[model samples]
Target: MEKNAAELLKKYLSGQCTPEEKAMVEDWYLQLPFQKKAPAAEQIEASHDEVLDRLKQRPKTRGIGYLKHIAVAASILLCVGLGFVLFNRKIEPMAGLAKKKLEDVLPGGNKATLTLADGSVVDLDKALNGEITKQNGIVIRKTENGQLEYIIQDDPDAVSGTNTIATPRGGQYQVSLPDGTKVWLNAASSLTYSYPFAKNERAVALQGEAYFEVAKDKQRPFKVRANQQIVEVLGTHFNVNAYSDEPMQKTTLLEGAVKVVAGGNEVRLKPDEQAKFNAASTELVVDKNIDPDQYIAWKNEVFAFNNEDLKSVMRQISRWYDIDVAYKGKITTEKYFGEIPRSANLAEVFKILELNHVHVQVSGKTMTITGN
Candidate 1:
């Protein structure tokens, strides 16, 4: 197998890298042994961050796997090296961030749920915003703004079974927990709140998709139980996307720390980091490069894809607008990188794609993608 710059650098770093990765790195570094630097060289300086960034990513693409994931550990360690060269460049400043369209969002999709302490279930997608038919020992109140708020007063003895709040196709909702923890539920997701709720610790069961801004309570930790994995925290904000369609479940931390437990393995994630778990393989991965703006786009009411592709982007649009997407293989290996406001009309969303030269035709609720 041929090795790239990433592979070469990993091997040049010695046994510091895994044996499986050494070959790829050795090949790339061997090509530039005499030059000592990369072919696409940046300005050389210890004080410039780009220099350090190049140094860090120099060998990252060399077949980085789960076993080697803990290897990179984000830019925390490389900050000093990156700081040496970054923030000192005399380049022109740009706008902070602009709004994006509906077609933009990271792949892997989202989740949400509707709960009844009695165990009876109501799919959020099928349920209307208003009075949900009452069940045993519980009252369901759907806000006009489309947030599902459940109130349980009669269950003094604590219910045994869990009441699930799930979102179906073409659905999205938000929840403000009693503790003031705001959760945004994406399409086709569900979460179960503990019965009578924990007195000391505020815990909840989650599946599909949800983002949490946990109310700070040091005395009682907030626990989110997802498929196969458990996210434990006291007071922190993070996003968990555990869609059943995909074999992987991901938890991205925007602020505060979170411990992702998957298959007896535990990985701690810091702020601005994401932990991706493969359920089929029972593997845990850590991606350090997180764009909070991109991750929290839904919160701010926008669609943002950092560096996503056509298929991935299409799925996101389907979830948000509740549409079926069809595309031919003509647009193979094409990438879309842009943002659009969520409030924009569907036409506006399609315009972004047209501008990128991806011929798209939208009719009613169905849109097809053709051409690269």
Candidate 2:
């Protein structure tokens, strides 16, 4: 029975489990108590023993079926606990993983820079909350909650110029545009727009990634230009990821409708649909019925990966942690699926990755990944 349990666990790890078996293993894992912090070295073995004993005491029923499942569950818990300990020991030789805590990299926060029409820059991180500046009948204020807000004043004679807001690596920011549109910029992203907007339309240019809640104005359509693609909408909620490092630019719509135009091709996206544009091919593709929440998870302070590839996952980590990633060996093709808080330190995030056979070594502002 023990040998059978071990075999089942091995199969589960190697992605060979049948649907029912996979569900069973995952259910058992999810039922385990969540640990707020890593367990001490002394508690490791004792905790393992207690959990194993509890699983073993379950009454036998329906021949080998009941006992077989209990044994498998015990093995899964044992393997996970042991893997955590072994990974810590292999990564660093320190007293009970204490050294790892000290070397951890903290997560990102609200940090950005605002560039006025005259090209003067203000570091939002250092600037005091309240009226940041006024230009051409527009009042720029940094709110108490650290958000940037624009208040438009009546000045028909004023000529509005372009203003830009940018966030550096390991940073993010929220801004309310002059037209009442709210945008949340992710790390290493920028948004540029004219204050007071144009008389005919409301338009903005984006780089990197941002989530937008457009203000309703039937006469003036809102458009976002990124990566040679333009997303046009009347009033909608959507997200755009147009990082130059990425293979494709994606525009995801959460509500209302949007049309993505690129390279003489256009695709209209309904709610919960995503339009992907690849610059290399100059082709646009539309995917329907995707969960919009996963794309905007970062805005909500969470890292959500839905069967995402390793390189893509690392790209997100690199931007948010302000680290450079290099591969030592052939990258694994394994797809990762999970949600980790954006607030977790680098070490905690790496620990989760290590469990899935993706190892990371941190040095200064760089991270090296080696696949098992």
Candidate 3:
């Protein structure tokens, strides 16, 4: 039997519904098949419109990449308004979106996930930093040094070794391979490497943010599998961020030659070159004049913004900190130019904004801004 929406909403409002009841309401509202162009929707949509404006003004967008990316968007959107409500006008009710925030992270941060070869999954968000999980001949441990590492399975055929490491939104980790190939996994990112990566060929799978300084292997060629693309190189330094939300899977070459292949399309890049991949359209583009710091700053414990918009900026913040963003009024489409050190206090981030004439406010963990 189908439950009435009004009844379910009232039950939720009164806190008289079970967990199941609340979920049913959320599913019904958010998953509605028909997109009704309601008149009231427009009248009250300013709040959300303001959010969209703020998002557009900042710089770029993850572009409905998936649910994981959208989770923190609302938090960053509504961050400024959160300190105090907009004057007088009825705030547009993002019922469906609001409910999602409750079901996910409220604001300030997100969680991560770990998958084993055996198909077991660990939610890294709730778990502590050290000694997370182990399985499938893989010893998953957080070293006393406070980084996530995988001990490759020992096998008779294993002349060399490899393993995979991945991180999800509201999550980040670092790893040091036996051969001293250091990797830093960013929010909503993943990587896979072989044990004693073979002499002839070295390969790994990656999505999202990672900084790699490949060990010099004369005999073996290192490769990274991301989305449908593969990046091949022998010895070099580089960063890859291929979040599904963004339009492209970017491979930024720091100091070596790398061949990026998308589908049958292939392109080679030299130092200071970046390969961009579009997952939806499956287009490959070779871009010159790249910014290496802005691409790989996360590895250095910093979030660098270079002429980026609110939507795009919020996307990064949403993933690392796992929050929701909303807004009221006109969402200005503008670009922000700044380099925020990851270790910088929240006040520092706002201070930079204030200096730029970008109005910003912080309430607790949520950070918001008003565009000019």
Q: Could you tally the backbone clashes for each prediction?
A: 26, 0, 41
Q: Candidate 1 lDDT, tens digit per residue, 1-372?
A: 222333334344546655545533333223221234433211122223443455556543221121122222111122122211122222221112211322332222223445566446666555677878555445566777667665666655544444566666555668766566788877767767754456788788886778998989888888898889999887788999887766568898988999899977899999978898998888898888766556667666666654455677666667766677888656745444445555555544554443223455545556666664
Per-residue CA lDDT of model 3 for 240-350, tens digit only, reads 887878866899998978888996799999887888888778789988855666688777666666556677877887676655444544555555543455554333333
Off by over 4 Å in 1: 1-140, 150-161, 199-202, 218-220, 246-248, 355-357, 361-365
Given candidate 3, what's the lDDT at residue 31?
Answer: 23
User: At residue 359, what lDDT does model 2 achieve?
Assistant: 57
Can you rank all candidates by TM-score, best first?
2, 1, 3
**How well does each candidate superpose onto the true structure, as a TM-score?**
0.61, 0.76, 0.59
**Top-TM-score structure, candidate number:** 2
Which number leads on lDDT? 2
**Candidate 2 local lDDT, residue 221:** 98
